[model samples]
Target: MPYFSICGVPNCPNFAHAVFVANYLSEKLPNFFYKKIEKIPREWAVFLDELNRENKWYTHESPVIWKELYQWGGTKYLIGGLSEFWEHVYCYYGLESLIPKYALDELALDNLRFFADKRRSEARKVKNVAILGAGQLNSAILIQDLLEIKTLRKGGVHLVFKLYDHHQNIDRSVFQHLNDTALHFNSTSFFGDFNLVELYSSAEDAMADSDIILNLDDYNPKDADFGKHMNRCTIRMKMLADHLLVAAKRDAKIIFAGSGPLCYMATALSKACSEMFPNIVVITADKGFPFVTAASEETGIEIHRISAPVVWGSIGVNCFVDIRNAFFKADVYRPYRCSLTAPKGSTLPLGVVSSELRLMGYKIKDAGVIERKVKNNTKKMEDLIGRASLFSKLRAIGLLLKLWYADEVGDEIISLGVRSNGSFHVPKGMFFSQPVKLSESRVWVPYSNYPLKEKQTKKRIKQCILHAKDVFGNLGIMYDPDDGFDEDWDDYSKYLGEIGEGEEEEMYE
Candidate 1:
């Protein structure tokens, strides 16, 4: 009827031996029971000291043992260290087959690995994601996407979404409904156990220790004046940037998802915190363009198969989609064969053909059809949402986040608003939407050598850059033409065919 407690550092040889003996005795003796308590090696000394002070015993090292003599009027008995326990068991139970030194060392090594792996597993399970201005509809869609996406389910990651919005703006009922949905899904779905949604009263509390911060703040102005909108957006962006500087970690990615000049806002935030600029990004609405979606619907091809349709310039205005290098994988194509009936020396449009996959470059002749479809779709979306395609934008954000979490950056090309490192003819210190490949390190590298042979493409890109500068100057974030002459401004002015008095006003407009 003896009950014992064994305490020691987790990976100690003596501790392993003590545990082995205790297990052996508990199995043979029907009335015997024991408990094992493990402490890390660094914390062992303090624990051992406290144990000795409480028990009035002077014992050092690991494998400290004690017996509770509850059967005999609840008296406590100290049994000293590992050797003493071994001797007591040997004399009392007549057991003498001691574990070999090498075996005990191996046992300790196994315990060390187990402890290390357990710590790593715990670290991998918990991921903190902060959503700023989470009361928006797109934010709700994003939350649902994160919870239900199959790609995220594979990692066994427990997602903690910390939602923050202003007191007047935030919807508590929406949060309550989402929480109820999460609970219901967690019981029914296989991977929904890993999802959790939390609401925070303060922005600082929500953003603290966040691995990914999504800025879904609704900053678009109701005013029709573009200049006034930019000015208001600039003021709000600066305030958010200041908050992020104080609360966000150095490595946490701050993704801007607001409905404004996305590239300019991202650039302004990046300039505010230069050291963390690389981690700041804006998910572009390139893949969500009406033309891209129309192509998918027309050809019956999955939108993901259509890759590398570069969206250059900014998000809303002065943006251009280049499909010159776009490739699509499909099982069927138009019934035009490259035979003698066709033009002489015409070859197949296929790039890579295999048993499982056939990748083909998009034909330039289909551009007219796609353009018409784009116009139709654009008009429909504008009529519905007033120039804001909420569903498409939500899908784009969801897709980007899925790819980002999966970290399987293959040959897929995505358009992201990232800080320009003077690559792809984009100016440094500005955020521009360009075709980029995600590296294994999770960094988005712009395709610097991507060809821009078409004169119109080049001209459009130049105009976008100028428009970005004008917007920044109007908001007083960076540029100021009235103060003094700048090198980039002077150079762009000369390149754009010597702007006249009337042309200057038109360019800004």
Candidate 2:
């Protein structure tokens, strides 16, 4: 009955960060393989074992034997200093599955220190971690971390993991590496701090009281159409909605996310979750901080934005490596178009996100939004939207703006909101992206009629709204554009409305 969760059918990076956190706990339990790479060739074990005994972490210098050991394994090493330290951690712990890539560095280590201090302040530390559909290299990396780790959390709850993989090979292979689990693996730092339990249950069973639900699967976008993807995503959401009513505890967070192309599935999921679980807050997260700009919105200010999932994943994975002032560290802005691989010279997985963040809130101007408030002004990035077909861009924006208002329940800020109450003379539910800044985080729209500064922005917003009918129709939903009420649509609907063909004669009579 412990709290456990999955965000979505996330890909490699998300899984990796989950594992990074799962096995990472303060030195209170048996964590022999914490930070160790598993499933290594037998050839290098003895060499690593002997070398590990002689190394100490305090030295800025790499051990003389580290290079020779690297050649013995024929590894493609990126950072030599980091490689040496991690190799030392692995050999000392008597564990495997680590590659040269996932090593510790100064900045990453500093981030860890900051994270530990933050976690230490929390009331509860250890919690249950469940990974759903984990079947990639990230899975392997995660099992290693969950099986053992070093971390400090607020409530002193060292995270334990319950991994779910349908494939026999994946489950069996990961299970085999956890042989030491029964006996409780040994590590100098975590000799007898706490106990970790291994849990295995059906996905539905684990949903009960889960603090998080990561919806990271069903990413197939049919015929390159997001509406098609939403069709599939909607089915899944319906199932989850039914299941969660009886299973999920109140306040559980469900993040509809994944890798691959920007599909409308997440958008649909957001809408579906809100409709299904009125009491639960649904969040959209990804391990990637995808780049999106409000510059073209014709707004007063344009600030570069990264969604929450990416920021969380980046810090989670970094703690697996080293540390830094993560509490105040807005991770380095690494732009990735799309892929599993990290940027060059970095072994951490690619930063990913659902891009569910399309609004610019007034709270952004508040302190702590920018990790340390280092910059005086927000930096602008070239609209990475890149030129795309009109329909594609429209669909993309829908996903970005999905649940924009709903997600800001507690932290409400002025944002682009839709016309729901007919305050704008637009159709009751027409797409209306207005200045929805909150008078306060809890306040909803329309404290005073805040108007748009530019006509072009309004036109652009109107077009996006008009196209929603198309997006809806693609998903087998119908809409009569005439029912829509916009300045342009009103004139056109009037032309097409109640008047018969060539009615000018009747009018003259």
Candidate 3:
């Protein structure tokens, strides 16, 4: 899910008003969530300095631009400056251009109330289910739900509750729960780990024996000493994905128990599985308050049920149970059409910062959230993984470039504008495509927001103006790849010469 942050000094008139609007908006928007942190007093800085555990100052201080942005972005449009901090959201996302005015209006307090009060229904058609992760709390609730679902099954849909996890200890306990539950019901439940062979068996069995796989993996990060829990989860998912591809025959619904922070483990695992087994469905639910349910439109995940924080304590627990019943009968589950947009004809190097940025963008656009992409790739999956990573980097770059050049360059001509990273949502307005190469080693492609033709025109115009200004003045800016201005203009000169000659009368004629 995309995260949004609102910031300012708590007592400041501008800050207080923004908070009021933020609180109201959080209450209003079905898709939007909020995390409010109280301001840290400047006087407390001395106290913080005294404690000095790695000088956590860096952690508490907001980014340099974010503070300035909070002042500029949110103030103009908010109610009594209450939403002043949100201006960053509008600017960063280019939201005015992307989000329809109607949609924004729908998020208003009155509009949300109308939608919330309407006759809402839960999904009830799902039968066969696979439950991943064998955590005691999650598994216990999952088993109970399956038992209830079994009573609904009169052979309409065969149910398979396939359980997966990385903890060997938890596996044993999960099996005991499954066995105990099996004695009471006629449903089939299976368990496995990261082992490819085992994963293949479990996934194949589920595809044949089940309809929906309820993944309840622990999204919590494990201690470094114990090993990265997320990495373990990804490894398990990769193995599970390979097995799912070989095992699932036709349409299968794969639902994930979303992590606390929308970990990419589930997204990556679901994405990989979807790529190979395009027929399967994937859905994820938020674990926070106003718990939203998203059944994959592409992977067949949709965000449903935006319950409040208090509801998360109990109702959220029951949401897993509710989903099983809803799964059997709901048509709300739609496959994600193009959320995980991969780079065309390019193999992204895994763990590379550039590629990761692209993957993040793709995932955000897909899920409609500002969640990070999972870092998992191997020698064999390098190409696909590269595409994922590069997509993420591109999205980040688009936002950065937009903000970096926003003031000096007007929006009409400036291509890159940087905004708050937290404000992005899904079904990316941006398109991903292959680059038009200019040389064997060098290729030129437009960023996410710019179309090819527009980019080409802008690039030429910008280059011409830049060179003209450079020749007129001694603007000796160093050429560096980091800044967009530092391009190999030799290519530009050649390109310009070709155009210039094309326009001139031919001497031979």
Candidate 4:
């Protein structure tokens, strides 16, 4: 018995002929058995090349046939292509014409139609991800991360990246590089049925039908003066809010990844689109860098071992890295142990371990030292490169996105700058970075399980609220302190007494 395998492009005439002949032979001869494999026309050449390499044969073209020699330990015997298969059948089994020319043509045409329809269906299922600052380093890094994600490589919903950047700032070379990478991935079948990476000259076109929008627009201020820098950021944020309001989909999740006042920008965006796009959630991803850095340094653990440390308040100077609820792998640090002994290879809360260390007379660096370290490192990188280092920030954004899309994070908390609905005793309608967990529906909500009872922590959060108000006032963005708060809500104004105006100024200085 000869077990035959036939493979070719679905739309090829020879494929139809081969399929017809195989079916006829199987029906007439009990000893004959065969299976047909359909490949897309674009992949036919690669498939043929792979087949040839594996079999040590030089055959090419559609409808390549081979037979399994069952008696010879299931070894494969090359039977060549459609014409060769016909000759083989004629020589061995005394069979000649099987499929008519009209039938072959009709079958091939039908295959072509089916293939076209399938491609159209797949295109419709592909999700569009729009990158507003397509040429920037951060955008490039983010795209690279997206391409390497293993879930996307496995067959599922495909992605079509729509890249848009200012005409003068757009880097065509970067786009070409990303396109070439995608093509290489396709050639190797790394990305199954992936779509194209398109560059859009118009923002509106780029944002159309987009499932996600990553705002990586470069707003790094070149001005040395504080007032001038504030003015530049204000203008850029206003322009971005306007563009997003007009172009972005009402349901789309807009991520603000630009280097500016992230909390303020997210607040402005949320406020601007609140009425028309009420479901629109603006996520500021800048706080991830500081949050991770502080956690790793405090725990004396590897960055990857640190799970989550919440960033409370604004993103930059006013932000406080709260490790109260953060956890790290206990196995990473053998010497450090909390008051209670935990099983090996378990996770431990960072705050508990830090407290144990302090009780044991081991000096732990204060929050001010950790904050200074982050700021100094950023400043040093800027001084050397003439621009702010984006690698840490890029990693932060990637981790945040991963957490956002993942099914669960267990007890780990993620720090995100989201508009406050009066959670954490902060003023209503203010954009503050708080300890948050992803809900069952994948929405980020304030993590209220661990009460923020630390008096010092509460006081700093109040100061942050004041600083945020100052920033909004300076930028001419309106915010109501009492908005969105319930009538029974306790007076948050009393918490501000602990943070003096001079102390707030000196903290940033």
lDDT of each: 0.70, 0.36, 0.34, 0.66
User: Of the pair 2 and 4, which is ahead by lDDT?
Assistant: 4
Model 3 agreement with the true structure over 1-509: per-residue lDDT tens digits: 33344443333344344444446656766655544333345744554344235323232332111231233334222111233345654654333223344544444444334323441211223355555554423344444544443333554433344554445344566566545544444323333311111121244464554554555445555565323453455566678778777765445545444342222343345444646332221122122211122222223333442111110011111112111112111223332434346555545432222211011111123322311111122223457654212222223222322332233332321111111111111111111111111212211222233222222333443443343223212211112212333443445445555555323123213
The lowest-lDDT stretch of 10 consecutive residues in candidate 2 is 316-325
In angstroms, the error of model 2 at 270 is 6.7
Candidate 1 positional error at 161, Å: 1.0
- Superposed model 3: Cα runs more than 4 Å off: 1-127, 138-140, 143-172, 186-204, 207-209, 225-231, 258-263, 270-509
Q: After superposition, how far is residue 466 of candidate 3 from its true place, in Å?
A: 29
Task: Rank candidates by TM-score, best first.
Answer: 1, 4, 2, 3
Regarding TM-score, does 3 or 4 come out ahead? 4
Q: Give the TM-score of candidate 4.
A: 0.59
Q: Which stretches of candidate 1 lie over 4 Å from their true place?
A: 1-124, 138-140, 148-156, 167-195, 286-289, 296-305, 329-372, 381-388, 407-409, 479-509
lDDT of 4 at 284: 41
lDDT for model 4 comes to 0.66
lDDT of 2 by residue, 111-132 (tens): 4465457645553455554444
- Model 4 error, position 227 (Å): 5.8
**Model 2 off-target regions past 4 Å?**
1-201, 222-229, 260-276, 279-452, 474-482, 485-509
Error of 4 at 57 (Å): 47
**How large an RMSD does model 1 have?**
14.7
